[model samples]
Target: MGTPAISGDPKPQITFQTKGITKVYDTGDVQVHALRGVDLALYEGEFAVLLGPSGSGKSTLLNILGGLDQPTDGQVWFRNQELTAASERELTRYRRDNVGFVFQFYNLVPSLTARENVELVTEIARSPMDAREALDIVGLKERVDHFPAQLSGGEQQRVAIARAIAKRPDVLLCDEPTGALDSQTGVIVLEAIERVNAELGTTTAVITHNASIADMAHRVVSFADGAIARVVVNDARKPARDITW
Candidate 1:
């Protein structure tokens, strides 16, 4: 269902809307419910953090929104298009043209330099920024020629972020983007994400277990038992650099 516009109220555009979304995985012996009737709305140019412990369904919801997976029941919308009703080919195109994903691991090809890694995405994108430009956005211009082995953990993650943003995607979905790094290094990675959201106006959603990171988001959505427990809108968002843990 489409989000109804309120009269005399200027609502920010909804980038994603999910209604009664549910996901069930059959693992032979058990049917695991990954999402339980989740209703969510994400606004354009907003930074949202999905805060929850492991197995809380945050990642499952992200996967659905990113077109990586489908809901077993209910519907999902990306702007005007109904993702749940989309064909496999359409979903593929949707992921390629609009969604950018960053995972817990920096899935970089070890042999490729940072610039080359970013280049892989740019070449396939419909309208892409220069590989160096993408690296610069993540503060990795100097390390563009450096291989993954030459860079630190945070630097490699930044490279992954650069590759994700190179396509200028409408949505950026990050699943535990900073989970592997120390606090200092994690902050650096978050800064890159913050900068990307601010400068490019990408609708960004990040999944994290760290409560401290919630302060950086425009909205914090807490999940529990495969359902959303609460959603807190941050009246005064903190800068990523100021956050610890």
Candidate 2:
């Protein structure tokens, strides 16, 4: 399938853009292509869901957009900055100042309370929200003092969401935020992510294999064989609470 054209009046601001980007992993005697000439644009304050099976390049694209990995060829732009040309120091700074990341696992410190775990990011952030405020946004105000071990799986994921957004990043990238949870718990976690995008106007991109989650996004990009196979613009988006599996 061809790349779908995006249509909008007074075109929305593009938060991230990639042109013909490709990624290749070189093993001892073989080369594995993770992305094959991908071209995509994510708009400001828009919630986008990337849907694909394993090794379809969704996570690889997310990592490159988050500055955790570099594409082997082509170019990437974050607003007006060309990330493909940035040095390692610049990339690190970009990731620190502009991006927020959430993964499947809750990487909270075992010994730190929820608030303390969030405080670690706020302490070094350029301008951060109070740890308590971050927790409140994720519906964990009452559990701020609890450690990760004390919270339920969904609650722990919410705390992870809080930590990622405590810095008030311009973009939020999540790789399978609910992959480890049951349907009910996953819905709660999705609600927290939906809230962040709605409340903070953060440009959010979520990578998921669950097709139902696509119903909650402004745009759904489907990947196949390391390339985008289709893009559907959702005019009637459902709330994350309505999603299942």
Candidate 3:
């Protein structure tokens, strides 16, 4: 795909921009402040890793960017389009056409084969790659006919990845994608994500508590106490295969 409008020279196009974003959830008698005055931008085609402790706003920020949740305050933009001002229906369409998501759980239908699971998304997409091609991208072409029950946990996660990217989304957001797997399995999942970012140039952002995973990102955003604590640009990125616990 071609690049979006350039925000400036000498930098990749900005995919997401958030200004003073805040989110507060009311649980009857109590209120939880999730994000507080977070201002950040994710660059096009750059792989970013979000690192923070639990309840530190990393996931909250990601959810807002992915259009899964709306913030209580501040402004957010997908390229030049303002997401904070979008209607719910528009947000739904935006997510469907532009964003791809992967979570800790595989969420594959038990009875569906790996290719069939990925086909669920491709069937509804405007212009999608062949389901088998998507599976191939994640190194699962051989297992395309295998049911979820027949695959290992890592293989299942790769199928989830294939489902997400089958639509050729502009941005891929991963939330604790490898959280449920062992180190070896986590590495495999990470490699799939890395391949998607590198091969397809899908702008990618991952939420990971594992600090070692930061080496695989072009930049790392660290959150603390519902705000951004620091942002680091990696001088050189290490492949997921070289990343060890």
Candidate 4:
């Protein structure tokens, strides 16, 4: 047998592979070091949670990963493309084609119905999934026709998630996606995000102050003093809606 025939499965795509990433902010002669060289690798379709205390650089890291901010130093690569050195137009296209963002506040257009708000992004995207189908994945298909004002906070957040995924982006960046709601409502929002991640296989990173959310992630990174203090990989991940911690 001449070197038993190897069936090669092409290497799995890497969503983000960052090395020695740093972010610094300057305010009136004061230098704020947000991140001091963070090294991370997020494989395609991984669900990662960034956990930390207030003043930690989780948000800053997430922003840099999502193309909302550039690093002060170091290299940032997404799908083998160097995001850190990419031009503004290239970054914009990268964000539009490859990343989606969700924040603490449900940023739905109040004037638009749930479906319409999601449709807006799809209309501007290169290739998009159907808006109604994306909403359905978040358990909001029944509420698609309802305006933002007509929906509850949980419902609105679900719509916001649908909007984010409608573009069929490879990476989903969530900064405190459930921060603004009560625990009960927040759980619902998290469940919606979980459903999307499971169904769409979108690489996700959630920046959260709630350490409880860490159990739901495949990997949890703890940030302190603008640096990662710990990284834990949970072999058994708790579902968002089922987690009490």
Candidate 4 stretches greater than 4 Å from native: 1-13
**Model 1: per-residue lDDT, tens digit, 1-245?**
22322222357789999999999999999999999999999988889999999999999999999999999999999999999999999999999999999999999999999999999999999999999999999999899999999999999999999999999999999999999999999999999999999899899999999999999988899999999999887768899999986
Give candidate 1 regions above 4 Å deviation: 1-10
Clashing pairs counted in every model = 0, 0, 0, 0
lDDT, ranked from best to worst: 1, 2, 3, 4
Write down the RMSD of all candidates, one decimal each: 2.9, 2.2, 3.4, 5.1
Residue 191, model 4: Cα distance from true site in angstroms = 1.2
The residue pairs that clash in candidate 4, if any, are none
TM-score of 4: 0.93
Clashes of 1: 0
lDDT of 1: 0.93
Runs of candidate 3 exceeding 4 Å displacement: 1-9
TM-score of 3: 0.95
What is candidate 4's lDDT per residue for 1-245, written digit by digit as tens?
A: 00111112134456787788888899988999999988887766678898987778999888888888999999998887899989999999998998989988888889999989999999999989899998998888788899999999888888888999999998899999888888888898899888777778788899998989988887788888887787887767899878664
lDDT of each: 0.93, 0.93, 0.91, 0.84
lDDT of 2 by residue, 28-144 (tens): 799999999999999888899999999999999999999999999999999999999999999999998999999999999989999999999999899999999999999999999
**Model 2 / residue 137 / CA error / Å:** 0.4
Alpha-carbon shift of residue 166 in model 4 (angstroms)? 0.4
Clash count, candidate 3: 0
Off by over 4 Å in 2: 1-9
